[model samples]
Target chain A: DVKVTQSSRYLVKRTGEKVFLECVQDMDHENMFWYRQDPGLGLRLIYFSYDVKMKEKGDIPEGYSVSREKKERFSLILESASTNQTSMYLCASSLRQGNQPQHFGDGTRLSIL
Target chain B: SQQGEEDPQALSIQEGENATMNCSYKTSINNLQWYRQNSGRGLVHLILIRSNEREKHSGRLRVTLDTSKKSSSLLITASRAADTASYFCAPYALYNFNKFYFGSGTKLNVKP
Candidate 1:
């Protein structure tokens, strides 16, 4: 079975703080993604990495960035956390392309005050 | 913006009844996938149907896709209380590798 693990299950941060969410996958998948899920808004992609050092912006990448220094780890960084950034963050990994099903890690529920 | 939109934001059904959800997308897709997420948990992949395929089944779950209309339907037979969750449909475009646009999801509640 494939396992995707997130660094934190819940986090609370003050406004204007820097936040980092880490994700690691044991399957060595080539694609990693970061998304923020909100009620009525759905899961909007923030950023994605296809390979080490290669990153692509999704529909909603503002105020957020991603790092993929290694194949197994992907990190999401918030430049300046704001109250609006609070939501359920999810990390997912897939074998190669979109055709394959993505395995997700337990989401990190971030609350910004 | 959400690429896929599911019909019926919420649904309630008896335990032994079957539940069906529909999803519609705006663009052409390489494949359509269904996912289930329990309250406060990560999503679990339920099934995947490619554009060329019309219908697929796994266990008691059935998925049907219509690329011509850019829509798909998922049916859960004999739903139990445990089947209650939010179901999302994700459409993957051909040009975007590993980038999927997800629906808002349909929250289903199976009554015991």
Candidate 2:
């Protein structure tokens, strides 16, 4: 079966600390994305990578960055954790084109204190 | 920026009843997709309708897209308690299919 794996199901970090969220997909998809889901705002894009080492800014890329060192793996980095950044982070993978469906990992619920 | 906006932010219905959700977008799109997410879980893709396609169906889920109106709707027939989840509409712009925007979503509550 196809699967997208997130390294952590839950994470906690202190303010001003750096945090890393990891995601991997075994489906060999070309497009990977990072999004944060909040209570009223829904899911807001942070960043996405189409190919290894190629990344693009999403709608809300202010407090986040991503790295794609391998096709199967994508990493989201939080330079400095803040309380407002606490939310559920979702990672997804899809075919090279958007016409195809995207596969998602369970998600990493990060809490910044 | 989010392009799609789902109407009836929340809906409540009894089991075996049909549920319909609407979505409106502000720009041209290459395709529109629907997704469902249970509480505390990742989103699951429900359906996708290309710009050229008007309607598509899968199982009990039906999706309709109207490019002229920049909107779409998802219909769930005989909804079960399991169908109670948040539904989101995503609209992809132009050639970048992966760059779609998602709305806040419509939370459906199917009471048994």
The C-alpha lDDT values of all candidates are 0.93, 0.91
Among incorrect, acceptable, medium and high, the docking class of model 1 is high
Best by lDDT: 1
lDDT for each residue of candidate 1 in A39-112, tens digit (9 for 90 to 100): 99889899999999999999999999889999999999999999999999999999885689999999999999
Q: Which structure among the candidates has the greatest DockQ? A: 1
How far does residue A111 in candidate 1 sit from its true spot (Å)?
Answer: 0.7
TM of each candidate vs. truth = 0.97, 0.96
Candidate 2 total steric clashes: 1
User: Model 1 chain A, poorest ten-residue lDDT window?
Assistant: A94-103
Listed per candidate, the RMSD to the true structure in angstroms reads 1.1, 1.3
Model 1 lDDT, full chain set = 0.93
Alpha-carbon lDDT of model 2: 0.91
Stretches of candidate 2 off by over 4 Å are B95-97
